[model samples]
Target: MEEKFDLLPLLEYIPPSSLDYLEWVSVGMALKHEGYDFHDWDVWSQADSRYNAHEMESKWASLGHNGGQPVTGAFITMKAKENGWLSRQYEGDGMETFGWDDEISYERDYRFVDKAWVEGKEIQEPGDNWNPVEQLQTYIQTLFSNDDHIGYVVDSWQREDGKYSVRGSGVYTKTAEEILNDLEKYKDQKDLGWAVGDSKKEAGAWIRFNPLDGKGVKNENVTDFKFALVESDNMSLEKQNAIMRELELPIAALVYSGGKSVHAIVKVEAANYAEYQKRVEYLYKICNKNGLQVDSQNKNPSRLSRMPGVIRGEHKQFLIDTNIGKSSWEEWHEWIEDLNDDLPEFESLAGMFEEDPQLAPVLIDNVLRRGHKMLIAGPSKAGKSFALMEMSISIAEGLPWFGFNCERGKVLYINMELDRPSAYKRFKDIYQGMGIKPANIQNIHVWNMRGHSIPMDKLTPKLIRRAQKEKFDAVIIDPIYKVLTGSENDAEQMAKFTNNFDKVAAELGTSVIYCHHHSKGAQGGKSSMDRSSGSGVFARDPDAILDLIELEVTDSLRDMQGKRATANFYAEKIRDENPSYLNEIGQDDFLSAAEMRKHLAAALGDDRAWQISGFELGEVQKRVKLQTAWRLEGTLREFPKFEPVNLWFNYPLHVHDEVGVLKDLDYVGTDKPYNQRKAAVKSRDSAEKKAERKKKTTDELISAFSILDEGDGVVRIGKLESYFEKSRNTIKNWLKNQDVLMIDEEGFVSMRLELD
Candidate 1:
C-alpha cells in the first residue's frame, strides 16, 4: 500500500477541547475518507473559493506542504455547529455526513464565531529540505523583506504545551535581514516565537515624518507599509475574513492572537510616513464603506502584530496565508511605481459647525475654545511657558485662568524645548504659585520630548494617539519650534506643522496651544499677532493668538525688585470675537452720553436707558466700545447740582440712591468720592480712613455679587466672602442697605436689581 496518510491519528493529535483545532482536524479527516488526501493535486483548490488551480498549485506546494491537509471553510462551520459554540447566529448550514444520505453546505453564514482555527502544527516535509523552523523564518523574512525600519521582539517564546514564556527582552530595532540572520539563535528555544512592530521607531520613540534630514541617522526607511486587521469582537472570524477578501486587501498573513481574534496583515505601497498614514486612512475608509469594522486602532505605525511562527498562549501561531504581497524590495518599489497614487478622503465636515445660537462651548472663555488652535507668543523669557503652565493647570482643575472662565478637563503638555528636570520644576512651581496642591492636579499629563530631538511629522501621530487614548481636552506644546525640523521662516514647512496641530485638535475635540518666541523689538506699532517670529502662517493658522507685551520699566509699575511688574495680555486674534475696544479705538475716544444713548438704542432696541445685567454690558463694550454700564457714585459729585444716583453693573437708565430709585430705575449711593471709598471699620482706626475703606469695600462687594450671579440670582455667601475678603456680617450689612439685594428664603443671596 502506498504510504497511507493516517488522518485519524493526526486528528487525535489536535486537542479536542479546542473547537478551532478540532474543526480543522475533522475537515482533514473528512476529506481523507472521501478518497482525497494532501496527495491529491486539487483538493484545496476545489474546496476553497480563494484558489484557482493556475494561481495556487505552485505557491501552495512551496509552503512545505506535502499536500497532506489544511483547514477549509466547510470543516470549520460544521464543527462549530456540532459543538454548540454559536448563538442564534445561523439560518441554516452543515457539512456533508460521510456515510449518510443527508448532506449540508459547509459555508459559514451568520455564524457568530468570534474565533477560528489556523494551522497550528508545522508541516513536515521530506528529507534534507527546509526544516519547519527555517520554513517559518523564511516566511517571516519574506513577509517584511520589502519594508524597512521594522521593530521585533524575539525574547519571548512558547513551550510545546502552549504556555507563553518571556526572557524579559525589549524591542529590538532591525531589518528583516538582520532578524533572518539571528533566526538560528532562537530556533532551538521553545516554540521559537517572535512578534514584529506595526510601526517604525528611532531611539525607542515613534519616528515622525519630516522632509528634512537632521544630524542623527535614522533607521532605514520602509517603502512598502504593512497594516493589520484585528477582528471585531462582534463578528465571527469567518465573517471578518470574508469582508477582507471582499474588499480585496492585499493580505499577507493571518495570525491567531492567542485569544478570540485573528490579526490579518496587509501590504500596501507607501514611500514615507505620510504615504503610510494615507494608505491606512484609505484602509479605514474602505472598511467603513463596506460596513466592516477592521479595528482602525491597530493601524498605528508603532503597533505590533504577532510574528508568523511564534507560539502564544498554548497555541502555535503560524501563517495561514503565505505568498501574498511577498516580493523583493526592488520589485515592490517597481510594482508600486506603476500604480496611480490615491489619497484618503478628507475628514467629514458635516455636523461640525452646528452650534447653539445662544451659547457656544468654550474650553476657556475668549481664549481657548474647544476644537480650536491657539498661539501664545512672547519675547524670550517673557513667561509664555509659565502662562501656559498656569492655563494647563486651571483647565485640569476646572478653575478660571487669569479670570477667564475655564472648563474642567484633562490636559496634556508636550514639552519639546525644556529639559525634563526644568519642565518638572516649572510645573511644580506653577502649581505651588497658584495655591493648588500638587496632588490635586489630577488631569495634567506632561510629555518631555526634548533631548531625543524627534521631528514633528513623526511626533504628531504619536501625540494624537496619546491624546485620543487619554481623552485629553486641551494639549499644550511648549516652544513649537523645537518640535519642528524645518526653518520657522519657511511658510510651507510651518503650514504643514500647524495643519497637523489643527488636525489633531479637531480629531480629539480639544483646544491646542503652542508657545512661540516673539521677534526682537517693541510691539508699539505691530498687532499682537505680528510679534511672533517665523512665517506669518504660524500667526494666521490658529483660531486665536494671544500676545504678552512687556511694558518698559516704570517706577509706579515695578515690584520691590525693580523689575517690570506686569505684562499686558492682548487677544491679537479671536476668530469669532470683535477686536478689543482699547486696541481698536484710541483711549481719548470715550463715548459721550448722547453717543452712549444712541448706542444703547441700537444695541438694546431702545434709546431710553436700558437695563443690562450679567455679562451683557461687558460683552457689548468689548464688541462696540460701549460706555461701561456702571458709573461712579462720585461722578455726580463733579456736578454738585445733579441728583445723587449710585452706579451699579446693570446697564442704562438705572441709578439708585442710598435708599431707592424709581421702581423702573436702579441706583447706587456714595457719601464720599469713589477713590476715597473705604472698607468697614474692623479696628479702632481714624473714622476718616475707616469711612474711605468702607466705601471701597462696599463698591467691590456689590461688583463681586453681580459677577457671582450668572444670570441667576443665587449667590454663594462663601464665594462673596472669599472674593471680597470681608466678613459675612459686613457683606450682609451692605446688602441690607440696598433694597435690590437681599437674602432669599432659601438662605442664598439673590440680586433683585433688575428693572421691571
Candidate 2:
C-alpha cells in the first residue's frame, strides 16, 4: 500500500520456516515507517497473513519522511539484556538520552563491523564490512585503551533466549578493547558482527558519512538511521538534529511540560547499565518538577519524557499568561489557539504554585483549597453579624464550634459594628467551651473596625507577615462589609481587590477565610451571585464557596416546631458539577418546586467559602446537608474513623453533633439550658447511685461557678447548698464557701461573703 521501502514487503521475500522467529533489527527499522505496533509477531507465520490496515496506510503516507544517515551492513536486535547495551553503560560513558561529543572514534567503528549480522524472518545476512555494531564495538574497544572511564564487558555468554549475559562491577570501567577481542573470538564461529557510532555527532559523521559534510567513508554494514522520537511543529533538518542532540534517539515530538519548544527533549547514550538507570531516574525527575505525578502517569511506551516546556524569560514569540497558571490539557489547547489570534506575551506559568511552601498542601494533594470575597448583605436583624461571629471563630480554630469544620485557617475579624471587647468576650465564651486559651490563637487576627481595613487581598499577606513576623498560619475577615474597598457587585472594582487578595494570599501561602452576611430575602444560608450584595465578583475566582443558611434558629426543641429550620447548603463550584438548578426530577426550587433552569450562581468563582443561612427546612436540609447539606449527623464519637470533612460540615445552630442539634435542647423554652447534657448511663443500685453522686460532685467542683449581684451576705456552705437546693457535700466540693459561703468570728455558718 505504501510507496516506501516497507519491511513488510521485504518480509514476503523471506521464507518463514527457515527462521523460528523474527529478530529486533528488522522490527526496529520497519517501525520507523510502519506504526509502532507493526505486526502481531505471534501471527507472523500465518499463511493468510495480511498487513494491518493502519500500518499499510502510514507507510505510504510518508513518501519523503525518511531522514538520518544510512548504515551499510546494518543489523538490528533487542539490546540483548545479557552482554549488550545496558551492561555496556558506564559513568563518564554518560548514558544520556542525547549527547554530541566531538570527533569520530575510529576504533569504535571496526569492532561492530567485526561481529554480528542481520537476521529477518528467514533471511540472514552474515558478516559485512560496513556493520554498524562492529563499528560500535571498535569505537568502544579503542576507548577502553585510551580513556580510563570507558570499559568493555569483562565476561559474556550466550543465553538460550538469544542474548548475552554479562557481569561487570565497580563504578566507571572502560572496556572498549575487551569488547573488540571478544568480537574477534566470535567472528569466525558465529559469522555475526557488532559495532557502534553516532550518526548524530556531526564531526563523528564528518569522519564517517561524508567528508564534504565533515563525514568520512562508512566501513560498517550500517543503513539509513532511525530517530527515536519526534515532537515539533516542523521536521526540518535543524529540528531533527536538535532532537538527536537532546535525546539520543531522534524522536520527532517532544511532549515536555511547557510544550512550548523542542529545546527540552534530550538524549543519553548509556555507557553501562548503571548509566542507563540514571537516565530513567532523570526522566522521572523532570516529570516531578513539572508537577506530574509519576504514579498518576500511565504511558506504557514512555521510556521517558520532559516537562511541557521551560519558560526562558519573557517570551513574546510564544506567549502564556503568568496569572492564568497551569492549564489543563483541553485548557492549554484552547489557550494556544487564542494566542494565535491575539499573540499575547506568554509568561511561564509552571512552578508558580511552588513559590509558596504553605500553599503546597492544596496544590500537591488533590484536596480542595478556596479563596473568598464574601458579601454579607442581609438586613440588619437577620443575625448576619451573629452568623459571621460564629463562623469566624470556627476557621480560627481547627475544630468546629456548632456543627461545621470550615477548611479551618487563620481569621481576621474586620467588624465595624461590634465593640472589640464584646467580640472578644463572645469569642471567649466559645473558647471557654473549647478548653483552649483564646490568647494563644495566633492565626485569628481581628481588625476590630472598618477604618483599619486595607484591600481584601492585602489582608492575608500582611497578616502572614505579621503572623510569621509574629507566627500565625491563617487569616480571617469578619463581617465582610467592613473591609470591602468598593461596591460588592462591581466587577472591575471587586476584581481589583479580590485579584490582589488571591495573589497576596497565594504569594504568602496563607488560607484566608472571610465572614459575610447574606442579603435580605436571600433564600438560604448561602446566596448566589445574584443575591450577593456587591459586584458579585466573589463568585468567579474562589477554590470553593460554602453557603450557610439558618432558618429560625430556636435554642430549644420546643421552639423549632413552627419555625423555618436553619438550612445550610454548600456547592463545590470548581470542575463540572451540573447546574444546581434541577435535581433528580430536573426541578430547581424543589420546595417552591420552581422549574427554574439554574440554581443561583455563586458570589465567587473557583472553590471558595460563601456563607448562606436561613431556612425552614432545618429538619429537611439537615437531612439534605447530611445526606445533602453538610452530610453527617451524630457526633465524632459516632463516626470515629471518618475524616474531618464528614464531621460537622453543616453547622446549624444548636445542631451540635458534639452535643446534639438545637432541637435536642430546651435553651429557648424547655426548662433551663444548663439541664442539657449527654445521655448518662442510668444506675438504679445504691453503689452506682453513690458513684454517680461522687461523679456529680466532681463535675460541680470542676465546672460549676456561681454568679451574684451586689451580694454581701454570701452565706455559709450549708446555707448556700440549702438555698440552691444542692447537697452540702456537692456545694463544699465546688468551693461554695469561698464565694457563696461566709465564716463568722465564732466559726458558725455566716451568710455574708463574696463570689470570688
Candidate 3:
C-alpha cells in the first residue's frame, strides 16, 4: 500500500492571503479530499483577513469528491511549491531547507569552523587605557557617514522576566558628524552620558547598524540599507567569533555584547529595504546551516547592534575590530561560495604514479566509459531520442549500439520530451523492429518527466538521490533543452549548466548520456565537435561527442533500394509458402522486382500472382523514399578515433549500412567552394542525364527490333516507332545515335553483327 503524506506542514509555507477565491477554496477541497478535519482548514483559512466564519463552515460542507478528478493533497503540494516550499527530502535536524527558488550552493556542507575543534576566545574589558569616547567615535565612523542619521537606544527598563529591555523607540535624529563634534567638545566628561543619554549599568545601550531617516525608527525609515546584525547567544562567544571570522563575513564593525553574544555588523549593502530582507535571510540561513545558530529576529534593516564604549553591569560593550573580513558584500559572498565549490583536491603526480589508479571501465566500448558523460548531437528530426532509446535497450541487454559493443547494465532513460504513452510505445516498437527479446527488460527504467521537468541544476540532486540505490550504469536524458537552465549561447552559463551532468555522474557513479540538436545551417562543413548547438562547451565538456549528419541519398539509389525491398518482400513469402521456387531463382535475381515477379508467377500460378499484384510496389517505393540516411562521426576522449558509422533511420529502428551504399554519399554540404561546386555539379548532372537518356533510348530501340522484326530480321521504322512509343523520325534519330543498329532510306531497321 502507498503511504499517505500529511500536507498540513506545507500550509505554513503558503500564505492564505496570497491566493484567489478559487485557489483558497481548492485548499479546503484538497484538505477534505485527503481526509483532514474541517478545523484544520478553518485554522489555516483564519490566517487570511478575508476569512469569514460563516463562509468557511458553508464551503467546508460543500467540498466533496466530484465526478471529475478529486482535488487531492497534490494540489496543496503544488501551491506550496509555488510559494517556495521544497519537499521534506532536503530538510534535516536544525537545518532548514533553502527556499525552492533560492540559489543553491554547489556543496551543501559550508561549514568553516567545526564546533568540536573550535576553542573559546575570552572576551576582555577595556583596562586603564580604555577610551570610551574613542570606542563610540570609531563605531559611528565605521558604520555611518557624516550626513546619515543614526538611531540608538540608551534608555532601558526591566521586564517582568527580570531581563532589561529598551524603553521607547530610541533616538533617531543624530548624525555621525554632530555626535562626533559633541564628543570632541565633551572629551573631559569621562562617560557617554554627556554625549547621548545615561543608561542603567545592568542593560547595555544599542545602536542601529543601518543609517535611519530622521522621521522615525521603523524598517521603512532606514535610509541606507547597508548592514545587518548577526548575533548568536546560543553558542560559546569564542566559537561565534571564530565562525564569523572563518566565514569571512563582511564586517563593518565587530562589537562585543556585554552579557552573552558578539554582534557582528555584517555588510549586506542592499540597494533597498526589500533587498535587505532577502540578503539578511540568506545570511542568517547560511549561518544556521553552518552551525552558528544565528538569532533570526534581527533580519530587519533597522535592527540594533550592541553599542560600543558602554558599560553593562561589570562588563564592557566595546569594539573588538573594524573591517576585519572581506571588504564588501559581493566580495564576501564570492568568498563563501568559492569555499563551497566541491571540486577535488590537487594530488601529487608522483604519488599517483606510484599508486597507479585504474581507469573507469568502458560503458559503450570505445565510445564512453562508466561514470563519464556523452553527448549525441544532431539536427532536428534526426531521431536523437530514438537513438538514445536504442542505446538504453542495448545497455540493458548488453547488445551493440551503433556498431559499438555495450556493457550489460541497468539504465535509466529520462524522457523529457515525449508523453508517457508515446515514449513507452516507441520503446516497444524499437524492440520489435530490432528483433531483440527483452531478456533483461527489468534493467531499463523510464522516468517520464514531460511537463514536470525542472532545471538541470535543481534536478541533479533529486535524480542522484533516487538513482543512488538503483546502481545504474548509465543515465540517458532524451533531450537536454527541456531542462536547460541558462542562456545556451553564453559559455559561462552553459558551463555551469553542463556541470550538473558531471554532478550526476560523480554522485551516482554512472555514465550520463544526453542528446542536443545541431546548430542551424550546413553541419558537414564543420567538424563533429562544432555541430552541437550553442556554446562550444557543450561539445567539448562531454567525454564523447557523437554527431549525426544526414547523408544525401540519390534518386537512382532510392529506386534500386525500392526494387530490392519489393523483391525481398515477395522472396520471403515464396520461401515460406513454396520453398522449392527459391532454388530455381539465382542469388542475383532477387535484386530485381521483375525477376522476383516471374518466380512468383511460376510458383504461385495465376490466382496467387493476381492477388500478389494487388499489393502496390509503388507503396514500397514511397516508404523507401521516406527513409533518411545518416553518418555517425565521433570525437572521443578515452579511446582512439573510429571510422564514421553509416546507418539508415528506417522508422522505429536505425539499421547499419552493411552494404556500404551510404559510404560514398557526401554530407549535405562538401568542403568545396559553394558557387564553384554548384556550377560543377550542375554541369555534371546535365551530362549524366544526356548519357542516361541516350542509353535508355538505345535499349528501347533494340528491344523494339527484337519484338517487331520479321523472319528476315528486318524491322519497319513505323512499326518500331509504334512499339517504342515515339514518332518515326524520332526513332530514326535514336537509331542513328547508336552504333548497334542501322536504318535504311526505306525506314527498315536491322541489328548490326559484331565483326571480330
Please report the candidate that would top lDDT against the real structure. Answer: 3
Question: TM per model?
Answer: 0.33, 0.27, 0.69
**Global lDDT for candidate 3?**
0.84
lDDT of 1: 0.51
Q: Please, what is the whole-model Cα lDDT of each candidate in the order they appear?
A: 0.51, 0.36, 0.84
lDDT string, candidate 1, 149-181, tens digits: 354444445555444444333344455565565
330-426 per-residue lDDT for model 3 (tens digits): 9988887788767679999989989968999998988999999999999998899999999999999999998999999999999999999999999
- The CA root-mean-square deviation of candidate 2, after full C-alpha superposition on the true structure, stands at 27.7
Select the stronger candidate by lDDT from 2 and 3.
3
TM-score of 3: 0.69
Superposed by TM-score, candidate 1 places the C-alpha of residue 503 at a distance from the truth, in angstroms, of 2.5
Q: Over 4 Å off in model 3, which ranges?
A: 1-108, 126-149, 175-189, 211-215, 219-226, 248-253, 267-279, 309-334, 451-462, 484-493, 519-524, 533-538, 578-622, 668-756
Query: Which model is ahead, 1 or 3, in terms of lDDT?
Result: 3
